[model samples]
Structure formats: structure tokens, C-alpha cells
Target: MLRIVLLFLALGWNPVAGAAEMGDDGLHKEDWFSITFRDVAEDIVAAKGEGKRLVIIFEQRGCIYCREMHEKLLADPEVRDFIKANFKVVQYNMFGDEEVTDLDGEMLTEKTAARKWGYVFTPTIVFLPEEAPQHVSVRDAAVATMPGAFGKWTFLNMFRWVHEKGYQKDEHFQTYHARVIQEMRAAGRLDAE
Candidate 1:
């Protein structure tokens, strides 16, 4: 037992080893996030061109839940890899003055856009479909909106369901999440506790 402990210590093994770095805006920064002009229509087009779905994540400085999400759930290798492979993520500051163009061709500041979209929480994640209809705002065309932080399984499953286009199916997200949890538990990937 002592030798095993010494080996782990020498190897510098850490359970939470891969947390992303925080940006000057006090948000977690990752290489997977796109640095775009914040134009909804153009972003959607670009994301689709890359064969990836568009995902806008809104966060503010000093949000504990956002910190938890970035540090714990998103830091997980499986979740991070899946997101990087399948989604074009965009980070938006909830209270920022940066200009953003809405899908309907309206220009607004990030804060105004957040209000227009009715997002009341930090760490709100908006998932867009492959194609959006003309003359509609992003909020009107979003397929799914995650309002706040969630557990590792829920967060990963949400991304998976969206990537698989499960919204078109009859199965609800709650049901799907339960099924996924059961499968993970059975596979011993998740602790039963």
C-alpha cells in the first residue's frame, strides 16, 4: 500500500487534473470555443460548414455555478472531447458591451441580447439546430436551452442527445437521462452511490 501511494504521488496523479484556464473576463477558456464576431446567422452557417452544431454559452464574472461547471463537469475528458468534436461553442458575457448580431439582422449588445433571449441565469447554454429559419431570432429557433449547471451525466447526456438529434424522437430528456444513468451504472462507468 505504501509503495502504491508513493507511485501515485510520484506520477502526480490528480482526479481533477484538467480544468480549463480562466480568461480575463473571469470565464473558463478552452481551445474548443470559437472566437467569432457574434453574428448568430453567420455563426450558424460557419458551424454547419464545419459539420458541427452551434452552442452559445452565456456566463458572467464571479458566478460560482459557472465555475463549478467549468471545473468539474466540462473538465471531464469525455465531456470535453465530445464537445470539441461535435460542437462549435461560443462564449458570451452576460453583461458585456460587445456587439452581437441577432438572426433577424438586428444588432444589439451582449447584455441586450441576453435580455431579449430571456436568459435569467448564468451558465445558460443555448443549442441550435443545423439550420434556422429566416427572420427569427436565435431564441425563437433554438432547439434546446440549458438554464444552469447540472451534474456530469446530465451535461454529457444533453450534448449527446442533441448531437444524436433526439429532439426529433418522442423520448423526453428526463427519460433519456435516466436510461443513460442506468446504462453507465451497469457498465461501471459511474458509481452507484
Candidate 2:
């Protein structure tokens, strides 16, 4: 028992090792998230130039669901790596005072922008297409919007679907997610539990 305990300690194992870092704004912060001017149009162009899709995530301080997502789903190495490779992520505080320039050329604070975008949840994620329509707000131009927290499989499948431009296909996200789940199960990558 003593030797086993010592071995475990030497391996530096900890279940909570993957917890996300908190920013001064009290929101979860990831290294992969871009530090941008919050100009939606410019950000979209930059993301496309990098061969990445643009993803804007809205989160607030002290949101338990956001914490759950950061720790449980986003913390998974596979998910994190996938997002980093394929997406340019930007974070906005749902109630913050930071200025944001909407795709429609409307300038507003982050809080007002969230309201205009109809994001009432703490962890609303908006995925944008490579080319946004002129004179349209983000709400009108977004290809997909994921509200609130979700399990790992659902979250990962959503990312995959958006990255693949599934919104242009006849198969819906729900169906795509189901198919991915089935494939994962068959591959023994998902636990029955």
C-alpha cells in the first residue's frame, strides 16, 4: 500500500488537473482564445485568413454551467486540441462594459451586444461563417448558436458539425450528433456509463 501510494504521487496524478484558469473578469480563460478588439467583421476576416472558423463565446462571472463546461467538456485534451486547430475563439463577458463592434456596424457595449444577439444564457456560443452578410447583425448572420452548457459528446459533435458546414446540409445537428455518438460507441471510444 505504501509503495503504491508513493508511485501514484510520483506520477503526479490529480483528477482536477485540467481545471480552466480564471481571468480577472472571473470568467474561464484559455490560451487558445484570441485577444481581439471585439470587432465582429474584422475578427471574421482574421479567422478566415488563418484558415479557421470564428467562434464567439459569451460567459459571465459566477456561472456554474460555464464552470462545468470549462472543466468537463472543454478541458478534454482532444476537444481542446481540435478547437485550437480549427477555430479562432473569442470570449465576451455577458455583462461587461467592453465595447463591441457588431457586423452591422453598430457599436455597443458587450452587455448590450449580448442582448441584441438574444443571448440570455451564460455560455452562449455563436459560430460564424467565413463570409458574413453586409448590414446584418451577428444574430442574423450566425450559422449556428449553441446556448448553455452541454455534455462532452454533444459539445464536441456540435463543433464538428459547424466546422463541416453542416448547416448547409439536409442533415440537422441533432441527427449528426446522434450519428457521431453511435460511431464513437461502436469504436469503443465512449463509455456505456
Top model number, lDDT: 2
The models' CA-based lDDT, in order, is 0.89, 0.91
In the range 1-193, model 1's lDDT, one tens digit per residue, is 9898779878998644566788888888876689999998888899999999999999999999999888777777888899989999999999999899998899999999999999989899999989856799989999989999888888889999999898899988889999989888888889522
- For each of the candidates, the C-alpha root-mean-square deviation to the true structure, in angstroms, is 3.4, 2.6
lDDT of 2 at 139: 98
Q: Which ranges in model 1 have alpha carbons more than 4 Å from their true place? A: 1-18
Which digits, one per residue and each the tens of the lDDT, describe model 2 over residues 1-193?
Answer: 9898778878997656757789999999987789999999999999999999999999999999999889877888888889989999999999999999999999999999999999999799999989857899999999999999888888888999999999999999999999988888899899632
Model 2 residue 66 CA deviation (Å) reads 0.6
Cα-based lDDT at residue 2, candidate 2: 83
> Would you list the clashing residue pairs of candidate 1?
none
RMSD of 1: 3.4
Error (Å) of candidate 2 at residue 54 is 0.6
Top candidate on TM-score is: 2
